[model samples]
Target: MRLIELYKSVQGESSFTGVPCIFVRFAGCNLRCSWCDSTYTFQGGKPFTEDEVVAQIEALQPCPLIEFTGGEPMLHERELLPLMQRLLRDESRRYTLMMETSGERPLGEVPTEVHKIVDVKCPGSGSAFGSFRMSNLDALTSRDEVKFVLRDRRDYEFARDFIREHLQGKVAEGTLGGILLSPAFHQSPSPLRTADNMELDARDLVSWMLEDGLPARLSLQIHKFVWEPQKKGV
Candidate 1:
């Protein structure tokens, strides 16, 4: 598979936040979001065979949680599927798998055992906005998650309406996995973090969610706070 870096880090988003996990970051992406933090993943990565990828993952060790993320991991589902199968079916250890995708690809083939964290780009995400494959909503399982990255009240409202329309009663009915809304961050590749890295404050987001009673979780990329905001491999 075409690869970026494979490293162990604490999961910084989704319901699995703060958990120690191994991140398999694949290279290349189709969409360019306004606030994308991983633009480095769009191109230029070392090549690795499936076996090489497995060896690196095993080196991380002890952390049973593994996340397949990328510029977009779904782009390599052809190879990823078998890798996930091997890890899940390993005789020495069992790994909990996770994937983060842009929700623009067909997910019908993804295994049910993998925790899929799909993103529905808010209008503020610019070019990637409305690029989500609406059909993927039907593919989400109870172990899956739908994420919305917001930049302002307008984006928050868009998320609210989306859940109201397509994700109707999923949260209340417990038929689907968790829904999440996160503030877009101004990413800078620097060691000294800036004062305004976050475009939308988490407090304001929480207020909006409470007032509207949106049945979703408030997701903060905790790694940004724990480490430098633009630092890679975390």
Candidate 2:
């Protein structure tokens, strides 16, 4: 596995926020989003064999949650599936595998057991040119989710409208996994708290969701608050 870093941390975003999770952050990404926080993952990282990666994960045994994220996990196509399969091999592991993706990759190759958190890039991310596969929506189970990181009012508007136009039916029935609308944090110079980490305000964004009647939830980077943002591990 071409890995950037592996460490244990509380999940900062997603439905599993606050849960202690072992993160497998891989190097390299196709998109250079304006608010990309893990810029460190976009370049050089230590390479590990699939077995080595799995061993590191098992070392963090009790976490029960493993997140495969990246500069873009999908970019490392060859190793992802094998790593996931290896991690899930132990029923006793009880590990809930998750991956954070840019939504630019084909979901067909991803193992069904992995909970995919697909971040549908909004206009403000500067990756609007990237094609999002509409067919991938069908592959998402209730355990899967879609995410949109908002940068400003324009981003919020785009997100709100996107949900209304392409995602309303799913939101209305509450059958879709879920929609997450978080403001872009790295763009905000003023840190939200003493943590000195850039991040979005959960309350402010949640209010927008309520006012717009959007089904999306506000996802804040809890780990950012608990630890230094630049730090690799919890």
Candidate 3:
């Protein structure tokens, strides 16, 4: 596997927030979102075989959750499957394995036991059309989540429309398990001024959700606020 970095920390997002988790950040991505933060994972990573990668996780004794994230985890198609299978075999670990994906590839390749968090990139992200594999969404269970990082009101509208148009009929009618709407964090204009950037404010996002009664949760990248934002490992 072309591994970028791995470490143990509190999970930043997802329904399982604030829990201690092991993160396996892989190398390379297919899309180029303008606001992407992990440019480091796009290339220049040290390569490690499946066994070596697993060994690193094993060393993080007592970690119960594992997340496979990256520039785009699915890009490294060769090593991902075997790695997930190996994790499933570790009886002693009893960990909940999850993956953060861009929703560009065929997810059937992933093991059924692994939870998937799919990202639906918004228009403001230059790579808007590059995300969201509509065909593979139904393949996901309630355990999976669809996330959108809103850059502005337009992006939020796009997300809402995408959900209503594509996912409404496929997923069960009443309630969906996990759907998150997060605003992209930007500080160039001014760090303390929350609404300085084109990104939507949390209050506005909540208002939109309440007004339309959208069936999705709202989240923030908790790790970015909890620790040094630039630090590679969580």
Q: Find the candidate with the highest lDDT and give its number.
A: 1
Minimum summed lDDT over a 10-residue window in model 1 is located at 187-196
TM-score of 3: 0.91
Per-model lDDT? 0.89, 0.79, 0.81
Ordered by TM-score, highest first, the candidates read 1, 3, 2
Pairs that clash in candidate 1 = none
Count of clashing pairs, candidate 2: 0
Candidate 2 per-residue C-alpha lDDT over 126-171 given as tens digits, one digit per residue, 9 for 90 to 100: 8553457777877777778899987667778888888888777886
The residue pairs found clashing in candidate 2 are none
15-81: candidate 3 lDDT, tens digit per residue: 9889999999988888888778888787888889888988888899789799999988898877898
Please tell me which predicted candidate would have the highest TM-score against the true structure. Answer: 1
Candidate 2 minimal-lDDT segment of 10 residues: 189-198
TM-score of 2: 0.90
Which has the higher TM-score value, candidate number 2 or candidate number 3?
3
